[model samples]
Target: MDTDRLPGCYRHPDRDTGITCTRCERPICPECMISASVGFQCPECVRAGSGTGHHPTANAPRTIAGGVVAADPHLVTKILIGINVLMFFVALSDPVLARELALYGLYRDYFGGTLHGVSTGEYYRLLTSAFLHTEWWHIAGNMLALWVIGGPLEAALGRVRYLAVFLLSGLGGSALVYLLTEPNVATLGASGAVFGLLGATVVLAKRLRYEMRPVITMVVLMLVLTFVPLGGSLSVSWQAHVGGLITGALVGLGMLMPAAGRNRALVQWGTCGVAFLLAAMVIALRTAELT
Candidate 1:
């Protein structure tokens, strides 16, 4: 067998390298071989394999139970944004209809009132209200915020944890609104959840010891925008925004808590339990005062 006939490394053409990349099976020279944590791979192979690669193979394709592949391929944030957009269109088509189905129920139908049936309860509103926005602008604003903050946070925290933060924050926001506002007023929007995402970003930045200037600036600007009177139109729910912000900060703190020497699951569960208890208390107190 003529060794000279063997394929040479892509980087070192002079060397007759016989070893092929585990992924692409392309011959590579010692100079071109990059040692990964798992195995030896060529620069081209690694570059085209994963993590800034032209063709990533190391990243697994996400699949649901029963082997059903996801369509969007992102996760909770995209799904949430999609739902909000769809609801926005629905609301735009018929404001009255959208309100009757989702927004109006946030107060009269979900809270304590004549329309509060078995299906319509305060417990459900905590989750449902987050999906129900009043108008196109309402959903668009929230979705824009979600797109800005939700993707990075979700990617950092993972899907399940990200979902927990979003849902809990939304619930916490709604609970606060229900506690503070009059029962006659109908409240609906994803602003609470979006605020929660903002809070999470702040916490994450702090934990990572990254620069906090940008995050602080955004938070301050958001607060100013919410409170400052614009054209004498005070239709925004500052309470919900505040509530979501608080919930997100708390959740982010929970995530940052030291899990090194302690049981991670226990700490997470305990934190979540406390958050839910607090939300429940707020809801209960508000319901009592309203009725």
Candidate 2:
């Protein structure tokens, strides 16, 4: 080991580390380093001789949050952005699509037709609305935020967990909007999910022991923007933003917290389950009220 200049982790090339695997002598990051009798060993070395009576297989890399490292770490983020953009274009082609998808408790369309809503068993709108954007600037802003925040988040949490947080956050936001907003008022945008990512970013920064000022500042600024009325007619749903932020923070805590080896996945998904349960409860209560 060079005392002057430490090498980067072999598993995570960008992470500089002073620790080396006792077995392979490869530099390992804190996440990849497993404590051994003599010193720290890489995951491969630990698994090879675990006495499972199985042959040693190749080491599959993992992210900081115990997620399988994919060849393209940002795949999920890209897919989400793509879906939002695609939906935007599709909505532009057919205005009816927006009316059908946007979240609302109940409403009447311009043609005097009664538009079915969440209260009328049109529950799919909760999710569809998150991807629906009527304005180019709205989609652009949300997608840009998604790319900036989501790429790193996806890399850290991996595909499955990252996707879970994004979706649950969106649902949480919808749940809040349904509970608080006027029944006939329509609301739609990706801001809920984007705000959720911002919340997760705060957790990530905290977990990694990074400076909190910038992350906190960003969150406050976004929240402020959410409340500030844009020309009175264009009002951002602060309820959705607040709901998503809180949900993301809770879910991020579950996903990022250190847990016992066998129970890590259990703990992570359990948090997601709890979040979904709360959102479901909110929806149920609101639906009961509307009906």
Residue 147 lDDT, candidate 1, scale 0-100: 86
TM-score of each: 0.68, 0.81
RMSD of each: 12.0, 5.0
Best by TM-score: 2
1-291: candidate 1 lDDT, tens digit per residue? 874465776766765545566677777543344444343465555545566643443433311100112333247788998898787677668876555644232344344655641124546756776887755566767888998789767654556667777888898888887777755566788888889989988986675444578789999999888886544222678878999999988876775443322365466556767888898888777665655
Q: Give the Cα lDDT of each candidate.
A: 0.66, 0.83
Model 2's TM-score against the true structure: 0.81
| Tens-digit lDDT string for candidate 2 (108-184) | 67577875789899999999999988787788889999999998888778899999999999999999999999989
